[model samples]
Target: MTRLFTVPLAGAFALLLAAAGCGGSSTHDSTGDASVTIRIPDPGNEGLLALGKKDGSLAKALAVVHAKVAWTGSSGPFAPAAQELGADKLDVAQGSITSAIAALAQHPGFKLFAQIAPNKTGEGILVRKGSPIASVRDLAGRKVAVNKGGTAEYLLLKALASAGVPAGRVTRVYLNPAQTAPVFNSGQVDAWAVWSTYSIPEIASTGARFVATGGQIGSQNYSVWAVRNGFADAHPAVVQAFSRYLHDAGVRQAQNPASYVNVFTDAGPQAVSGTARRLTIQDLAQTAAPDGIRPSNVTDFDAVARFFAEQKITPTAVNVRPYVLSLTGSGS
Candidate 1:
């Protein structure tokens, strides 16, 4: 019944609030005890957010200043979530700097308040094992599924370019991750340009191999938190406090992702078991260590923007320096 894009933005916002039992509260109380209830997307087996929610650590940390946390909307793509933030329907959500760039190109609503370094080792182009697609060169003239205008397309394009395959040669089938699965499994698409979530699981369980990892093919997607500008301006302390909570939780996950895997991946539909569980744990441990919420690096994002613009993913290049904000308070 709740459609994110089908209804007007205001209507969608109202629906989300009603669905989440939110009282449409946005601003902090005048006393500034951080009593404002922060609304964010429901964390669904999503790394540190899931970890924090499962243990009640996020709420406990926010309660220090009398702030409350509300989980609104289903965990989904960052594109719609970005729109929700812009409309003041939600206060915060997990996003990538690339997604933030794409959002800003369309409209203004949120500013990236914090950043996490990219872990591209596990995000790559997934292909059937022994499929004859030995390298990026083999992708030429083939259909590849990629979510347009973001990391998926970017990674694939970079891989193709590295191998000197003209963009026009390969047919890029624009499909979201959910839509791409069946087509990919049926061999309708030669490869799936996907993030670690799907890539890791598929590789561990299914007989899938990466034509090239993001690292090997040269692509970067930094994890970041985007906050509604209104909320950040109205309650700076709340933002800082919440960011600090996320940073600390990220630290714990980064330190030992294997230790937290039971809770982190437990909520998903399929239980990761056997060899899949072992391999997933290994990949997560390596990828998690180098990442945590941290300060924004404008230069790296500029590179991302330039690539998207060249690929015509964005209407034009977007300058992200203004939106790259550094809120106080984070873990060591």
Candidate 2:
């Protein structure tokens, strides 16, 4: 039996109430009426699910396999979505590679199947204008805002380690992406480690400067899509169809980003401006290997797992390969 865990409804499942009637389960429906419940972050620009919903492409593609998509809104970090998946409340979701690894370490049924290309434009450590923190080395003993176990935390760790700063010296302020901007802008935090979604808008509004970027610190942050293993096994055809749909939609966005005006528009002016500044047509392109899990991905995941273990974020080292789903034969 799958162990069901409870998460704070107000925190993680705040947006989920809107889709209350859309039920989810681990067992695939054998009656030929198959459906998938996917958790998409509000204003999610990284995946095709949101864009496809607007353009009707997702519906058209899933129709080929006689499957349907039930879209649910997600907020904050990927932990909530991962928890929902583990509890059999979600069929598919996307999140940062670090968060996915952390989730897989805790949960047993999740599988990473596809990946989004890494973009270096927006991920970095930001300090307020005229702040004395001029470099990664300056972060020692400073209060830094980062979403715990998310990409921001991972990048901060890598940056600090690379700069020879003792991880224990920095005081980390864990906040959701929504809460990060307010704390950072109000000077409550010395620095904010964030990605494009929060960093771009903050910089544009507050003139915050980048102390160091993921690229500068040699951190590669890739976003990945994952699904429940039982669902994929029981409905391979549906999984393949959804993966192909995402790939095709990603290609379209890469070739013509302007085609996704609705997506940018829905994300708000700040997000719109951020998207324009941080993303390029090429950055949205699907460059993932056919198998989805590349050697570099494995190595990076292992490194993150080891880091988490060293930091006592995880109880033990986790091997990530067994949970990776190879879509090479999916015919996408």
What's the TM-score of every candidate structure?
A: 0.84, 0.80
Scored by lDDT, model 2 comes in at 0.67
Candidate 2 TM-score over all chains jointly: 0.80
Worst 10 residues of 2 by lDDT: 1-10
Model 1: clashing residue pairs?
none
lDDT per residue for candidate 1 within 1-332, as digits (tens), equals: 11111111222334323322358554333335546799988776646677778888888867654678898987667888898988879999876677788889996788776676676677878898669898989998899999867678878888888888999999999998877778888889899988876787678767799888878876768877888988766655566557566656666776777755666555357456776677767666665322223334677888889888998888888988677554333222
Q: Highest TM-score: give the candidate number.
A: 1
Q: After superposition, how far is residue 298 of candidate 2 from its true place, in Å?
A: 2.1
lDDT of 2 by residue, 1-332 (tens): 11111112122232222122225423333324556444444535544555777777887866655667676665446788888877777788777888887787777668887776565656889899989998999999899998887788888888898899988999999988887787887889999888876775677667888899877887767778888766765555566556666666666665666555446454554235453444432334423322255566777777777887787667887788788764442231
Q: Highest lDDT: which candidate?
A: 1
